[model samples]
Target: MKCRDGQMIPKEQRCDGIVNCADGFDETVAACAELRCQSEQFQCEYGGCVDGQAQCNGTIECIDGSDEKVELCGRRILVRPTTEPPTTAVPRCELPKQPLNGSYSVVSETNTTQTDYVLSYTCDPGFKLVGHSTVLCIEGTWPDKMPRCVQTCQLMKHPSIVYECTEEETEKPRQCNVEEIDGTIVKTSCRKPNYYSPVELPYMHCQQGMWSSGPVCTAECGTLPPESTPLVLRGSTAKFGEVPWHVGIYLKNPKSKKHMQICGGSLISNTIVLSAAHCFWNENTQRLEDVTNYAVAVGKLYRKWYHPDDEPFAQKSDISEIVVPKLYRGVELYYKNDIAIVIASRPFEYKLYVVPVCLDFNEEFSNIQLHNGNRGKAAGFGLTTGMRGSESPVLRVINLPYENYESCLNLTSPALSRYITYDDKICAGSLDGEALCRGDSGGGLAFPSSISGQRRFYLRGIASTSPPTNDQTVCNTHALTSFTSVIKFEKFIKAYWYP
Candidate 1:
């Protein structure tokens, strides 16, 4: 072959199956590229040309001749077999394929009974577990959605109070276990003297399953009583309101007959009497006297029915000690600290009719409010709307309503308009004086007849004062009459005066 430059013609200078140009410019240099055939100009010394294409196709004709310069090769490219190794088959021992962005694995392999494989699963961050941790993987796809491990429950320290099972040790702390259903376990127990309402007794439950959120442990603050238990009064039930007030003379009475005397009082306890404190005091000296003159004439439905008709009206004995807090100084006909405990001369023969009312020491009126709100009943033998000295011949029970404190403060001007502040006092009456009679003072306000019901009056506020000298009806005015909330003095009363 001659050079492209056509300068030399010697046969020895020709490309003779060897590369002589720096760039392998000879076309016959690839002549031994294993073309399997020996043409006179080009032939292979080993394997055949890849794809049956001639190794040198008007370009460099050897395996290494692929390095030829483009000027000599003229855009010609010689083909060759690729040298990459083949891929190996996948092994069966490896874990099943996971999704692109999550983690999953075959928890249990398929068996003859089930063609399904149980898959264990976990999720990326910020996700919560919603479904089962193990799911069936059938025919290369999961049978159900995979579960995720995530943060859900309100992270909590130990609970403030916890409930224990009937046989469980009291000393041990309560724990919240995982629920069978999908939800977080929260809440624990009830504190003493405060039992859960029966409906609320099964204290522990899942938030999402039962409640919309966390389990709120409802703790009680007062005496824990049985379900539907009423403070049963044991004596005769009087007429609608038939207890009479008898004004009689007692031995050792004031010789001058000028002494203020309260002939009848309610038996709050065997030892205590619910009477007007101002009735026994001297207006000038402000001194209380003659504790023994007091007597509780219970069951006196009518004044003249003392013997056969009324069964002698069960005469209870006289008092032992007259204990009235000295702080109770007469402020006005409107008595303050009007409450006095007459240590009963003897333990009361606890008859159903002579039951002691439960007292409200904390002033907390309700644990849960009823939808219609709480309407209470008040019974007394005092005056009516207009009659001054005309007291009811029989005790009368009237329905009364309680008013909010802040709203009552807005009426009759701020200085004169007052809200009930005595810890032992509670207030009742609508903005309009639509309820309560003149003789309702010094009576007990009962509460929460049942756990399921609104807090009924057992012993709440003591009737303290009437509203300021304003004509506005108790219902229409912004302020109304208030009673003393007894809860403030619960400890004081229970400690010193409770028999």
Candidate 2:
């Protein structure tokens, strides 16, 4: 070979990854490359080519420093041939292969008649695969490692899992087993409330030569729900399941835990009650009340309904937990987020009077223009005579129109107007004087959700504060009642409420 500087050398030095000339022309790719690079050979910088196996294998086989450059090396996994003898006593260290059984078969991957083609491998019906499935043929010799089919554990009698160390405990263990190889997955489930799972789905995985710790099912308070329509109440009277998502909150009378004081809640899911945060606030103490001292009644219109009705009457669930968001400074005269989740110890049985109601998430029915003079309906246990907090035992439905925005904006209290947000507070009109009463707090303001053909009543807002000025004789029909719109804080409700 002749160098660019007019020096000459033997032809063998051309592709040897060495600089033999002043200008390094003797090791140039064009002069070094014997022919078009093959699968077993690697193309280097400046058109140079060398044995691909030598590329990034610690030794620089390319004259241009391209062999082991960091860009091409990645994590530098030096996958030595599985057939190499182990360098240590560590079980995973590899060793050369022994003579294979003649019965095992292999075929040329490229052509049936070609002896220099790749070898493909597979095992019989019941065998574990190890190493690459294909090995390459180079210069009449296989340079890559050959794959093997090892026997798996055939544990007819075993526990929920087995590891390499306890393989002997299995009734039908693997034969000639390697020291510590990951085992196959075992199928089973943990009984009762306890659950076994790896990826949500239950499956005992024997990973890294042994059974790994998997996810366990623990008791949680709530789970959210999906799309559906519960029964809607008729003009005024609530039938069984009609307005099923509606719930009546009752605190154990301070004097007696057996007696209950009525409040209101909306059932968003199986075991969750969406209610007003003020329901748990003890005004006397100026603090939140203990959660364990409350109960929720579903599927009933009358707080103390005793007679049989055509629909499912009442299913009472003990309040196990209550979560009120921290956004509100405390229970204020103006109900802000005033929202809370009441977790029931037992799921309310879905019946005529008990069902779930879909929240006005995303304001999906915004096109309905509920705020633009649209009249919304509310089915609550109060206000036939327009009393402040007094509620009749029977549920009553009343249509309240959308009030002028200027009304909530013109409230005498600056704090009320300042805290009343466009999305959060909705001013419903009682132009002829049919506004909500104090007992209606937490009751839902539902409008017809005509999105899908179904007549689903989607809760738009929760009865927060109706300005308590209306009592029997002083009923102001033209007053606008303020409510916390459900669409505004549905996300915050879901995040803090749902388990």
Task: Give the winner by TM-score.
Answer: 2
Q: Return the lDDT, model 2, position 138.
A: 30
Lowest lDDT block of 10, candidate 2: 218-227
Overall lDDT per candidate, in order of appearance: 0.42, 0.57
Q: State every prediction's TM-score relative to the real structure.
A: 0.42, 0.49
By summed lDDT, the worst window of 10 consecutive residues in model 1 runs over 240-249
lDDT of prediction 2:
0.57
Off by over 4 Å in 2: 1-235, 254-258, 305-311, 330-333, 367-369, 388-390, 410-419, 470-478, 496-499
Under the 3 Å rule for N, CA and C atoms, how many clashes does model 1 have?
A: 44
Candidate 2, residues 1-499, lDDT tens digits: the string is 7864478878766655555565455554335435455677787653456787877687656655566667888766544432443476322212235424212233322211111344456655445567756444432445344667654544342222222232333545333233233455444333321112233435444453344444333221111123323333232565444566778787676564464545677887668888777778876776678877788877776756343652346787788888876765444545667777888999765443455676646644554647656767676775555645555667666767666467666742464465566756787755455676655678777676454343556667777665434343433334566777777776777774432
What's the C-alpha lDDT at position 289 in model 2?
A: 86
Report backbone clashes per prediction: 44, 8
Per-residue CA lDDT of model 1 for 330-444, tens digit only, reads 5543355666555656765433233344444432344332112354444554544423554455454444555555544543356544334534345555544443444445544
